[model samples]
Target: MAEIETLQELYVDELKDLWSANDQMAKALKKILGQATNGKLKDMLQASQDGIAKHTDVLKALIEGQDEKLKKEHCKGMEGLVAEALKHTVEEAPKTGPVLDAAIIAQYQRMTHYGITGFGTVAAFAKALKLDDDATKLEAAVADMHKGDDLMSELAESAVNVEAVKG
Candidate 1:
C-alpha cells in the first residue's frame, strides 16, 4: 500500500481494500450459506453473494475512474472478520438447526456492519473529492447493504432467534 498523503489517495486505497474485502466475504458466504438451516436465511445469503459481486464491479469501475491499477490490497480488517465468521459458523458451529442459523445471522451482520461503515466512509470521501457520480454509486451500495442487514434482523427476530430459543 502506498503512503496516502491526500484524501484522494486514501479514498483509492480504501476502494482497493474494500474490493479485497468483498471477495473474501463472498467466498466465505458460499461456505456459510450452505450451513444455513432456515430457507429464508439461505435465500438471503444467496442474494448477499450476488450483491457482493455487483459491489465488486462498482469498486473496479471506481478504481479505473481514478486511474489506479485494477488491483486489491488485502484487507486485514475484513480478514479478521472473515476468520471470526468462519470460526463461529464452521468450526465452533452449533447444531445444524435454528441455533446455527441464529449464529450465522450474527456473524453475517457483523461483517455487513463493517461493509456499511466502509462504504459510507468512501461515499463521504467521494463527496469531499467532488466525485458526485462515485458518491452516488457508493451511497447506493451502502443502501443495499443496509437493506440486507435489516432483512437479516427481521428474519432473526421473526423466526430464527425465536426458534433458537424454543430448542
Candidate 2:
C-alpha cells in the first residue's frame, strides 16, 4: 500500500479502489445476465457491462496520465455488495421470473449508487487538486452511473415490480 500522505496520493488510491469495483461489477454482471429472464433487463445489463468496460479504460488512462501505475486495490465494499446481491438474487430469493428481476434491479441500483458516490467523490478530489480534465471525466462517469440507476428504476416500475406482485 502506498503510504498516502497527500491528497494526490489519496486520490490515486481511491481511483484504484474504484477501478477494482468496476472490474468486479463487470464480472458479476456476466453472471447476472444469465439470471435475467426479462429481455429488457438482460439488454440493460448488457449495456451496463459495456459501459463498465469503457469507464474502466477511462480510469486507467486517467491514472496513467498522472504517472501512477494502473493497479487495482481490492474493493471489499463491492465484494460485500455482490454477496448481498447473490443472497437476494440467488441463494435466498427466487431463481427466476419477475421476483428475481425485481431483486436484481434493487441490487443493481444499490451498486450504481455506490459508483455514483465514488465517482462524484473522485471528481471533487480532482477538482481540488486542479486536475480539471480528470474531474471532468469523473463527473461524466457519475452522470453515466446516474442514468443507469434511473433506467433500472424505470424498468422496475414499468414492468419488473408489477410482474413480481402478480407472479
Candidate 3:
C-alpha cells in the first residue's frame, strides 16, 4: 500500500480495495457457477465474471496512474464475503438442485451488494476530487452491479426462491 495522506490518496486506496474485491468475486463466481444447478443462474454468473474482468482492467490503469505499482490492497471485507460464500455454496450447501441454487443466489447477492457500495464510494471519491472522467467510469461500474442485483431479484422471485422452498 502506498502512503495515503489526502482525499485523493484515500480514493486510490479505495480503488485498490475494489480491484481486489473484483478479483476475488471473479474467482468465487467460477466456483459458485459450478455449484449452481440452475441454468439461468449459471449464465448470470458468467456474465458477471466478464464484467468483473473488464472492471479490474480499469482499476489497474487507475492504480498505475497514481505512480504506484498496479497492485491490489487486500479488501478484508471481500475476503470475509468470499469465505462466507464458500461456506454456504461449497462446503455446507446442498449437493445439488434448487436449494443449492438458492444458496448461491443469496451468497452472490451478498458479494454484489458489497461491490455496489465499494464502487459507489469510489465514484463519490473521484467526483469529490473533481476527476469527472474517473467518476464516470466508476459510476458505470456501479450501474453494472445494480443490474446484477436486479437480475438476482428477478430470478429469486420468478424461480429460485419458489423452487428452493419446495425443498
Candidate 4:
C-alpha cells in the first residue's frame, strides 16, 4: 500500500523537486547561451539564467523561513526535458537559420511549459497548506515568467529566421 504523506511533507518534497529542476535548468541555459550563435537567442538564454537564479533563491528562502532543510530530490521530469533540449540543440545547430530557430523555439517552449506547471502546482500546494504569503509571491513570479515565455513565442513566430525557414 502506498503511504500517505502529510501536507507539510508533500510541500517540502515538491519544493525540493522544484529546486533541483531549477538548478538543472540554470546549468542547461548557461551551456546553451555559450554555444548559441544567434545574438537574440543568446540574450534570451542569459535572461533565463538570471531568472532561474532568482527563482532558486526565492525557493530557498521559502524553505528556510519554514525552518525546513534545503535538500533536493531528483526531478526526473526536468532531466528528461533537458536531455531532449540538448539533443535538439546539437542536432539543429548545423541546420539553416530558420530551422535552428524553430528547434530552439520548440525546446524553449517545452521548458517554459514545465516551469509554468511546476510553479502553479507548488503555489496551490502552498495555499492548501495555509502558506498564504509564499503562495501569492510564488504565483506572481510564475505568472510573470509565463508571460515572458509567451512573448518569446510570439517573437519567434514573427522573427526573420522563422520567415527564412518558410521561404
Tens-place lDDT per residue, model 2, 1-167, is 77889999989998999999998888878877788889999999999999999899888998998898779989999998888877787678785599999988988888888889888999999999999999999999899999989989999999999999998
Query: How do all models score by TM-score?
Result: 0.99, 0.97, 0.95, 0.89
Output the better candidate (1/4) by TM-score: 1
Worst 10 residues of 3 by lDDT: 62-71
Residues 33-134, candidate 1, lDDT per residue (tens digit)? 989989999999999999999999999999999998999989999999999999999999997599999999999999999999999999999999999999
Residue pairs clashing, model 1: none
The list of candidate 4 runs beyond 4 A from truth reads: 1-4, 91-94, 164-167
Provide the overall lDDT of each model, using Cα atoms, as 2-decimal numbers.
Answer: 0.96, 0.89, 0.89, 0.78
Candidate 3 C-alpha lDDT tens digits along 1-167: 76778998898899999998999989988888888888999999999999899889888887786787777789999999999999999989886599899889899999999999988998899899888888898899889889989999899889998998887
User: What is the alpha-carbon lDDT of model 3 when measured against the actual structure?
Assistant: 0.89
lDDT at 79, model 3: 95
Residue ranges of candidate 3 with Cα displaced over 4 Å? none
The segments of candidate 1 whose C-alpha lies over 4 angstroms from its true place after superposition are none
Question: Model 4 residue 30 lDDT?
Answer: 66
Per-residue lDDT of candidate 4, residues 72-158 (tens digit): 878899999989887887644646666665677677779878988988898998999889999997898797688769777876777
Instruction: Please give the range of 10 consecutive residues that has the lowest summed lDDT in model 4.
Output: 91-100
